[model samples]
Target: MLNIQSGSTEFWRAWNHLLRPVSSRVETPRVKLSRRWKVLAVAAAAVLGVGGLPTAGAASAAGASPVHIRFSTGGATPPNEMEAAIFSPELQKKGILKGYDKDYTLSILTASKGTPQTLSLLAADQIDIGTLGFSTIALGQAKHAIKGGFSVVVAQFVDAHPGYGANAYMVLKNSGISGPADLKGKVIGTNQLGSASDIVLRAWLVNHKLDPRKDVQFVESGYATQQAALNSGRVALGTFVQPFEAMEQASGKAKILFTTAEATGETAAIAVVARNNFLKEHPKAVKSFLADWVAGLQWLAKPENRTEAIAIMSRITGTPTNVLGLVYGVKGKDYYRDLKGCPSAKALQNGIDAMVKVGDLKTRVDVSKLIDASYLPYPC
Candidate 1:
């Protein structure tokens, strides 16, 4: 379980500042690869069998109309309730894990790239629910990028102080990189441009007294393509979450330069996002979905459930059990992963404040607007 401490004064200051009017919107800049790199992205995505969000919807099967909730594993990682319940037979007995719901059927989407693609799908009304990076959705909401009123449903994994958990940036083992100072003028690759990986990397740079805007360049690649790009010498450094993060390190090909926690304490969390209209349009269906979601989290939080949990996630994601265990997240220890589907306001605020300080977000958002807790009727 994560220690959901209150936000620091800096966070409140930033939040309050957002209450005031800003003269202009200062958008964080991202490195755009050339047309050649675009082709590379296509080829890499094809090789991985991943692409933009899926457009799969289902009609009523028997009696109750099926509510389709589309969600993706961020960067095709993080074994959240959506992926776990689909594979875990024990969780299936609880409800959603069985992969068949009386009221809801999941259309699990694959995100070849990162937040932008998923956010676009959400804005276009393509996906009813999305598993998105913490800052991605917050900044998107700040810009009114989402089409309707959207709220965070749960936390997938959260940013914590260094060493508390894993969300790391790695460089090829032989790549002459030691620390943040070494990254100046080098190309740092991450999944999404404006997502947690980007924000934390920039924060890490600034904290080390290097100017992220001038000192280094960011290479954008999808999670699936991240490893290929890193090993192929396309990017000097790469940032990854969960399975992929461990996968790279295990290959003996890369070593950890830093983690998000190391640079900026406890930033970058993942959550389920849903538009208010969808919640209202299908209240009962959404309620049941939330129920299943919580049940999945509960199943994961138990220590004895680890073996089955790993097997289920491995089957669903094709990631080995060793890599998948990190998502289960131990209780009251140095290690923690996943929010068990619930995240706190303070943790989310900490990430937003980091972005605001970094100028990644032009205006501070009313965070309350991004959360709708109605779906979870009781405390998990």
Candidate 2:
């Protein structure tokens, strides 16, 4: 069993700092590709100083240095922090993750502020792989913040696919707010200003003929804190995903007003994106990572592994096992994840178009240019 207290206090403090919202007024400076690549090469050299650098083909040789990959994830569930659980030592010992500590080693970065922060990290070359939402992919491309643009390699999770769990918008059961119109003048809580849930909330309000800007107020509250925000009447409505949603519903004090699916159809809410240069320089390692990722998902999906999987998630996230058991890895109860690591281009495009329709984005992005599924284990 994994120990929940294994993480150091300093690590958690840094993680919490990363989770805090980035100020809109502060601009994230973008580094040129050449400079970024030079920095990475220097860092690699520093690590392999004594042995000298080995060629890509020699990566898996005995005593060869492993490729260092920094991966950024947002939350502690299927779409986000699954990599952490999947790559845990326990799972690796069970052979669920075959690539770890082989040709590549992973450093998981927490982007609790969501894709926007991930975008910043990617632009600065702080993270090699990022779990990005459709909106951020489009935004990054439009702004040229991501050097060669986002090269999506795998699907993280799909939101509101058929019977799968969707992000929920909740309110106190006795709050008497039944519909969008009832939300007028009320304070709504969102994980972040441009997060997927926030975009869906705005779109839903517009569909109901209410102007999101004028009809309601939005407060930036973390997902972990949203339940308390709702209970204390700090915010009349709050957006929830996974385990948090399950916890709130089980309490019988909150009720779902609507879901992401109700606002917009199925969405490619999160997908694994790699820096173009990283994909080009480490194709073999990339392939190994994807293969392991698919294998991990398959292992977690098996009924026999359900209990162990829940325990792993609870340890990583500090969520109760019962709460995680309620939704984690349970088909139709958890978000839909593709076993082969193929994300739906159509779903991603639809999500981008929805953002444009809501006036959140000024233009539509060509989904084709943003995705490079050639690195996936299977065809996208």
Which candidate's TM-score is highest? 2
Q: Which residue pairs in candidate 2 collide?
A: none
TM-score of each: 0.75, 0.83
Model 2 stretches with alpha carbons more than 4 Å out: 1-63, 76-81
**CA error at residue 350 for candidate 1, angstroms:** 1.7
Tens digit of per-residue lDDT, candidate 1, span 256-307:
8887667667754666777666776777777777766766766765678778
lDDT of 2 at 191: 87
In candidate 2, how many Å is residue 13 off?
11
The TM-score measured for candidate 1 stands at 0.75
lDDT of all predictions, in order shown?
A: 0.63, 0.75
Tens-digit lDDT track of model 2 for 155-204: 87788899888889999999999988899999999988877778888888
Backbone steric clashes in candidate 1, count: 4
